[model samples]
Target: MLASWQMREGFLRSGRMATRRGVWVVALALGLAAGASAGEEFEGKLTFEVVSKQAGAQPVAMDYTVKKGLVRMDTKVAGMSNYTIIDPAHKKMSMVMPAQKMVMEMAIGSVEPPAPATAPEIVKTDKTERVTFNVVDATTLTLVKEGEAAGAGAKTYEGQQYAVKVGDRNSEQWIAKDLTLLAGFVETFKAMAQGPNAAWMKRVEWPGFPYRMVTKDAEGNVLSEMTLVAIDTKSPDDTLFTVPDDYKKMTMPQAPPAMPKE
Candidate 1:
């Protein structure tokens, strides 16, 4: 039989062990909370400037604004404006034409994209690098510019450079892992990259938000380049996602009657 003192000491030691275990549990909980917050979807407006290599082609400004589960895309060039609104949950898309004062509505199918039979190989560089902007000057690839001169007044982030190849097309992306796109938006975007027309996109995937993405052809010639020039975290007005009341609804034009066979 053990003495009272021995029993008391045993209970005290057990109490100490339980206290230490409690501390570990609390610490782990806190760490998990922090990780969840870091991975939360980014809600804001993103502006990407698209540069074309064709002669006499003007640079187009593409703006995407997300708020409260709604997405809006606006493109305006040479006094012509076009807007596309998408509601993923409801599976609806609306094309708002300001010039025509019309809204063309269509139902987007909720098709789940099939997983790629094989994941594309991604190579990451050892060091982080700043994104470079390709300046096109009058039908010529003038210079590969970097720093503020290339993207003035734009937010810059140093990210890991990844080389991604999808079939014949090749692309390089500067991805900032700290920033994540809205989960719903990513799903909807992937869902839309379906069907026979978008087979190439089905093979493309992003690990995180890309600050810059440049796609090149088989010959290494630049095809399309887009850079993120601005980002705003403030929630935009809900009205931006809604069609204007004054706009008239329009149906898709029907195909012309078939010619009679001889």
Candidate 2:
């Protein structure tokens, strides 16, 4: 059985912005509204689907809601639902289990980016494609380069957000163009650089959210993947950003002690 931290580390470092139950949302919304209402936070809803051939895991839906730097994610276990909230500004993360009515929280530390200029380079291609899904019409877009992988079709604002439209049934987002939303990413990437994922992480250089990514193992077997399915831009209820009043706070369990190094 995989330990909790093992599972969570991937979700966190993989640049997850939010998630949910039965319809997982994976969003990274960085924004500056163009003709959009002022004081508008980058609210977004998305569904994430994961397929793994090696693990033989059933395709499960994870939903996400994101606004500003706050994220609300939902998941389930044994038919019971669990929710997690990540607040980058406060540097905290909490897990709430509805069935148990319990809430567990942990304090997180922030990381500094290597350079403000270390952002992704973008260039337009002649290729064009239409992307559509729930609530979003058939929006045509042009492919842009991020690095080796070239599959982003988005309309750009001078120095604001990128409204990406990619393929049918996939969600779109307004990825932040500034350094504000990169705090969590900075921490995750810093960890990746020091961890085993260093080489792989450095090679890709994905600037913002990845709407759809398919990862395969060395033997060419599909390891796992996460893709966007749905999206919305309306601000979610404020309650979604906090622990429910019905849930009680619970102390997190401590890890087992490490063995002596000898």
Candidate 3:
């Protein structure tokens, strides 16, 4: 049986933005809105699908709706539905659990406790590639670099792909040129922009959002993958960003009192 941290590490190894339930929301929010114009606000929905090849890992689908700087993210885990609402204007984030009918709220960019004493070593390699993907339709995308039909007659996004090594895990990230709504939606709701890895992550200066990411172990076995599935420009309803009246709100869990000094 895998310990909780082991499972979490597996998710990280697969190139997830962070650990825990709100990870994807945090990761996708980071650097997402840097390109939008003030006069042209983005109000739409974006969906992503995460697939994990690691043992005991389940696929996850994330749906994000952005409106007037308010963002709502929805996903299901093990048949249970969960939601995260980010109100950047208020600098707050809310986690809604449907089954429990409870909501936990916290300020955005809250600092987490320090990690273990020894930080993992990470390195960026010199390898680079031009990845091309054929947009089959509004909801379909095919990786043309991987031998798809040459005559698909579709629009394509040329991706700047690069590799990075985090300890024993190797990951390849395919970043597409910043698209207005897609980039703006994420940047507006970024929750944890300055974490343990913020310095290193920002140092690279991603010219765009990473559309596809694949992580593999030292022995070259794939552990997980996350891909951009679709982007919907249709405006989402205001109700999707609001908390239901019947749901109870919960406070943050306080730590136990520290032991007496010797």
Candidate 4:
């Protein structure tokens, strides 16, 4: 684990731009958090700007709108504009490329994510006050990855993966039970290292979202981070989830490698 952390530290210190492409690895269902709470369900938009320090990496600003099982993400990257609509109810994701005037369709494996452990084993580590543009909410709890201490054998858990070369993963997040997004996000991902290429991948019993998440190499150097900029529960336009009449249907340019006929 020491060697792995050292390598990851070097990587982060180098700021290689190639890794920035992973910004899109967020959950296929970022907006799906059903059965979370009685009053938590509502439609609204979340706008965030993802900035990377990696060389040649261009910052991206995107908006996510959610209504029930539908989600629309409009993105602008490197002067190019495009978007995707994820329909969990039908297990379909639409990729709209305006330059090509085409809409690509792909099927997702699941819409209803695996429910998080009802009695998740929780181990608290640290706590501190967190702020968002002066909206302070200090009810914070930092979680620890049970078992597999640093310099020990590999950390084992369900769906753990290390793509583009693996590295030591020691993560902690500030969780709030009110958000109901942090736990589900963890349970939904790493169901096989499929944690959307982002470091916000660890699962715990916290019932809320993390306004601040920090992942470290074995040595604890910051790798990547995700900050919740805003949350609005107002319902969004229904049309955002629908493909336009003028869009031409096309097969996804890159499909998940087909399962072998076993």
Candidate 5:
């Protein structure tokens, strides 16, 4: 079986954002807000053709299927590998890594909010990074931030910035100036901080990674971009979020020594 690091590395190397969950939320919210004539629940399939390329490697094509609250990812890597099942409501995820011939399960839980800090303390932290939220009229919000990082400390403010705490990660978010959150930094950061299978928090702050995303269309026109995707809703269904009863389950032991990073 592939080591944890190996799996993570493979994901990173794929050149696709790992925050599929966040993207799903933002996409759904936006798609619904735009597509829906009135406030209503939406249920449909979203298909995206993922094209990836790495130095000295041939381009790779993959198909992604996302329903209301479920996702099934299929990739044509080494062997017909498939990644199925992500249920945030139940805090469970399943994966089928064909290259490693393994089926794995992971347990997850929702994040709780942090206690409020006093003004003096907030002012001190404001010198570095700070988050705030504000209401723009009645149907919109604004989140803003200004400063640098100071270790892993977190704070929340009310203005153009919003800071939400998710799990052990605190994400500082800045909402879009005009388009609410459908197309802005808040959606982008949310996607990066949380993976596709996790729940979304009102606000959060997390250590940023040293990577960026660039999106383009067939005509090479620069378009929307983000680091990962996040899905912040209940699980889709029992069958979609679990391993098939008929499939054989396998577990592999960890290697004695870790492989050196490439």
Candidate 6:
């Protein structure tokens, strides 16, 4: 069992990006509490069978594990490794490579504070009534409202989409017909590439598995597709969020030493 403060700290540290990707594992553990509460506590195991394909080559299979809060991805691909850590609340995330025995930590925050506009865009399309906007640029679109359409059974956003679901406090969500992309989806990738909240105007692509992405290679070979398998609302064990006592603690890379004082 873990202490409450420790759990709170873990929650606070996990940022929007990490939580968006793996929150389902925890949500599965939490069960019904996930529905009634904004952010119900949770913890559980996740097994990911990832397949990647390039032009003419056959798809490659990779297995991954999500235990507690740690993720271990094993593959022979370059620039990727065997271990990673994600914290959603605080916008802090880290990755580790067992072969290199190295760790990288990054602090994540919004690239730009949400615009000062009080109201989101409400549009009444021929099919339905909804609210939507590109918060940072056209890349990050947030759907603030939705109503039924006459003939359409469901809606779908086809391009550059990430995970879909209602978000908790500390984050906003962009919704399309059948998907939800967390605010941190774009924010975290931007922060990792540039710097904390670094600003750029060009449209950047959304990464990882989201509802909108189609798994295809240049030659039109079908890779693997991700689908929403299930959802759980029950509250999970409070201890699921904590770092383990037996696991080794690794340090992130050190920044260059400050220049000697003049």
Give each model a TM-score: 0.63, 0.50, 0.65, 0.58, 0.34, 0.31
By lDDT: ranked, best first? 3, 1, 4, 2, 5, 6
Please name the candidate that would achieve the greatest TM-score relative to the true structure. 3
Using lDDT as the measure, name the better of candidate 2 and candidate 5: 2
User: Which stretches of model 5 miss by more than 4 angstroms?
Assistant: 1-42, 50-53, 98-101, 110-242, 250-262
Candidate 4 segments exceeding 4 Å error = 1-40, 111-123, 133-167, 177-203, 253-262
Ranking by TM-score, best first? 3, 1, 4, 2, 5, 6
Task: Residues 1-262, candidate 3: write the lDDT tens digits.
Answer: 5665664444334222212445434434433333244444567776777899978989898777777767788886578667888765575667776665657665555333333233445444454555444565664444454555644565455567767665555667676664433555434433222333333343355566667777787888887787766667776889898888898675443211111111
For model 2, how does the per-residue alpha-carbon lDDT over 47-124 read when each residue is reduced to its tens digit? 556566655467656666666667777654345456777665665567666655556665543321133222333333
lDDT of 5 by residue, 1-262 (tens): 5677686566444313223332343332332333233433333222222233433543233333334444454444444446644444454445565454445554433332223231111111232323333443333223332353323222233223333343333333333233322231332223322231123322323233212233334444433323222222232344554565655353222211111111
Q: What C-alpha lDDT do the candidate models reach, one value each?
A: 0.52, 0.41, 0.57, 0.46, 0.34, 0.30
lDDT of 6 by residue, 70-106 (tens): 3233333344434344443444444433433334454
Worst 10 residues of 3 by lDDT: 253-262
Using alpha carbons, what is the TM-score of model 1? 0.63
Q: Write the per-residue lDDT of candidate 4 for residues 1-262, one digit (tens) a residue.
A: 9976765454343222211221232243533543223334435666555555456878776666667756677777799877777765676667776665656666555222233323222335445442323221232222222341333222111221111212444555555544443343333223212332232233333345444455456676656554445544456778778888897675432323211110
Better of 3 and 5 by lDDT: 3
Candidate 2 local lDDT, residue 138:
40
Task: Point to the candidate with the largest lDDT.
Answer: 3
lDDT of 5 at 151: 30
For 1-262, candidate 1 gives per-residue lDDT tens digits of 5765665455345334323222222222222233334554435666667787767777888677766556677776676677777665575556677765667665544232344443555678676865443333322111134533553333334578887665555767677655443332332332222222233343356665566677677788886677776556667888898988998664432211111111
Model 6: residue 197 alpha-carbon error in angstroms = 19
Could you tell me which 10 consecutive residues in candidate 2 have the lowest summed lDDT?
A: 22-31
Clashes of each: 0, 16, 4, 7, 27, 23
Off by over 4 Å in 1: 1-41, 111-119, 131-156, 180-207, 253-262
